[model samples]
Target: MLGMPVTSFGWSVNLIVYLIEEFNIKSIAAAQITNIVNGCLSMLPVVAAILANSFFGNTPVISVSALISLLGIVLLTLISFFDNLRPRPCETGSILCNSPSKLQFGILCAALALVTTGSAGTRVTLASAGANQYEKRKDQGSFFNWYVLTVNIGAIISATAIVYTQDNVSWKLGFGLCAAANLISAIVFISGKRFYKHEKPMGSPFTSLLCVLVASMVKRKAVISSKEEDYHNRGIGKEAKPSVSMPSKSFRFLNRAALKTEGDKKPDVDSIKNIWSLCSVQEVEDCKSVLQLLPLSLAIIFVTTPIVTQSSFMVLQALVTDRGLGPHFKVPAASVQVISIISSCIFIIMNNWIVYPLYHKLTHKPLTPLQKVGIGHVFIVVSMAVSAVVEAKRLRTVENEDHMSVLWLFLPLVVVGIGEAFQSPANTDFFYGEFPESLRNTATSLISLVFGISFYLSTALIDLIQRTTKWLPDDINHGRVDNVYWVLVIVGVLNFGYFLACSWLYRYRNLQGDNEQDPKDIIT
Candidate 1:
């Protein structure tokens, strides 16, 4: 939780600056590279989660991942400490600047690959592993909430301390600090091995979904027979409609999971829990809920795209805008993004203690996770609109031959941080609470997957804007960035409608037997 994100985000927070300044990469190319790197980082967790659930257990994967991460960080530090490991320093905007040689690029790519693989292994796996230590869903939810908080705290430290060091002191010292953190955290994790709960590995939840589909197809005729008998008998038949129960009736065909068989064993200590056989109602509901969660997840991806895109642009804005704080100090542009992290932390605490509690007190009910996500949608729209306004003002300042204060960028980013506090933890709670025990590991990885998709999509969107429109020139000041923000504002509006439709139709799954059910028949 603590060490892994610190290492990854240490590079992530200032990666564009590092690429642009150190390797002489173009500004837009640097941003695309950063997004691509992060997208891959965000994605590898799903693979790691599948491995943890289906094959190698969490401990071995995490243990190996930590060592790999340590090595990658060490390599990156070497690149920073030794000038010969990277391209020599180049003049700003010089046409004669040398590009990195193939060997230098290869070494950088290898180090990054190791880091991404290692970091992905630990992230969501550790969340599930920690949550597994708890039997109660409430306790599990609390653990995951704190898991997210811990990650954000690591990001905050990375963006503030590590970024400041990278910008103001030396990249060598900064990257060395990241390597040290990775090593220390790995030692701490390994030392606590004996105390950790080692759950029996369940087969992948994804396979469970497939089995559900197969089961339904095999029993597709059963549903037809039941309906026919009830119709012919005029409601007096023994099979009379099968009177749907715990799993609900929306996908009644899928309820084939609980269908009785001639050779079925009693719901007992053994046989009935077999993964390859008929399943219980609880397992049936689990698969259905996962299906139900799909649209909401897709809605989230689209709603969040604009915000993710703006986040990259904000760093670029800070770079060009005035960062001077006083006669002697200037704020590091990378550190400017930390405003979102700080505000997210503050709002997380506030929602836990203040906002949510106050709402519950006044309304006599707790705010739902869906509502929290909706609030995030509204705030991000406002943030984009605010960014557009701010950018327009900045462009005017540029036109008038003055540098706009970087402080002008603060308000929208703070709003973005506030929106994150609403969206992300609630997202975690929603999936963790609603998803069945068998799929918990996969559930925890959902947010990471969403980021993976959005980062990739956002990069593509940025490229399209750069190519088809005149909005994203190398010199952002000379481009129509405000227009880009406006386009994002429109995107936010359209996605909110889709989100609302999904929310309006979505049903909360029953959680009564979630923790107790054997997940043998489960799929993620």
Candidate 2:
């Protein structure tokens, strides 16, 4: 999983620069392409996870995705190598350059689409697969922490080393390296097949969920029974009789699906007749779990959208700022974002070893995932405020001088990195533990969905801000970019309130009591 990111990020991190410099695209157009690619990569994980959970399973999905990614990288390498594949370079100071031909543009989009789709497959499902390798919940939590750490490490290396190679060396050579890395990742992952604890694909849960919704709505007039005996059990083979004493009070309308009507079938091994009148208690519960989680997931989207917008804005800020690290060494504007990645890597380790352990020692109990997420929210708010302050200072300084030093942006990046350390792992652990057992892979994939939505939302926010206010003018020197960060601060605070309410109402389905028990040793 880590290896594939290195391969993918190599090209993806420097994509905006590649489009602007090599393809002769405008800055705004290049940024838009970056946003689209980022959104697709983040969003497609849910689709990939569903496929993994319902049909193919994680290892096959990840291996196949890696192969597809390699093909995309190979295509990208071809574009880099063949001058004919790109638009002609413009004269030194020309206001406009030749646009890419339709053929070139089509090929580029196809390559990007393939890479983004393949990336989505590996990103979330791999985390679920890793969690599956361990039986203990604590072990699973540890794996998730390391999972985030590896992601940050991969991102940092790609954002810095791979980006530098692309910018300074040959673009073909850089893309060639990405292809090689992806090939190696595929080989390494496949080689571990015999040792891996592969989860078999369960038939689509979405179908069952949809059935529950349809059945509940269709039989809304039916009287809901509180008796355990009234609900269909279908106690067959591994599916034991449900121990849920009664249906949950929340989403009371959905309880009607499990309510036995006159025509409702008993716990038969054969089949269920009326889809609208009959559903297993377990099925109804699974649907309820999703409904319960939806609000929490939706609330985080607002928090993340601002972060995504800030990331892109930060890169632009770096470009205009003085990026010199020393007398000779100058930081690439793209690479400056690695500050956040590096901080995330460092803080994830600290969060797992120091913060979590310290809290446990002090309280005689481990911090809950919701608590961790709340702490992350606080850090995110602080990060936004810092960003606003820094941007305001930068704006003031740049008015009198050529540029402000990029080093000033590090505080906000580091702050947000710390926030991510708390929130990201917490969100993953929460979803992985709280979601229905059958949908664990899909649960983990929700994190990616949050990010994906945030990226798309960020693009929309940017457009809206540009249209409404003078905060995001074409040039930063003329705009109050600080005001944009202030707006995000307000949004973060409001979203945090929504998160608190949802978190208070939610009951953990898998994390607390159920997961704390010790499992019997596997006979390996």
Best by the TM-score measure? 2
- Poorest lDDT segment (10 consecutive residues) of candidate 2: 515-524
Give one digit per residue, the lDDT tens place, for model 2 in 127-237.
999999998777888899998888888888889888878877788988888888889889999999999999889878798898899889878998887678777654445
Q: What are the models' TM-scores?
A: 0.89, 0.95
Residue pairs whose backbone atoms clash in candidate 1:
205-523, 205-524, 206-524, 208-523
How many collisions per candidate? 4, 0
Candidate 1, 1-524: lDDT as tens digits: 59888988887788889988889888888889988988888888888887888877788778888899888888888998778879978866766677899999999999899888888889889988888888776677567657778998999899989998999999989999999899988999999999999966776777667757776676666642243222111122463323233456778888765565554454342342543445555566667888889998998888678877887898899999999999888888888888888888898889888998898789665666777888988888999999999999999999999999999999998998899888888888788777776677778788888988999999999999988998999999899889988998898999888888788787665433543333221111
Candidate 1 weakest ten by summed lDDT? 227-236
> Following a full C-alpha superposition, what root-mean-square deviation does model 1 have from the true structure?
6.3
| lDDT of all predictions | 0.80, 0.83
RMSD of each: 6.3, 4.1
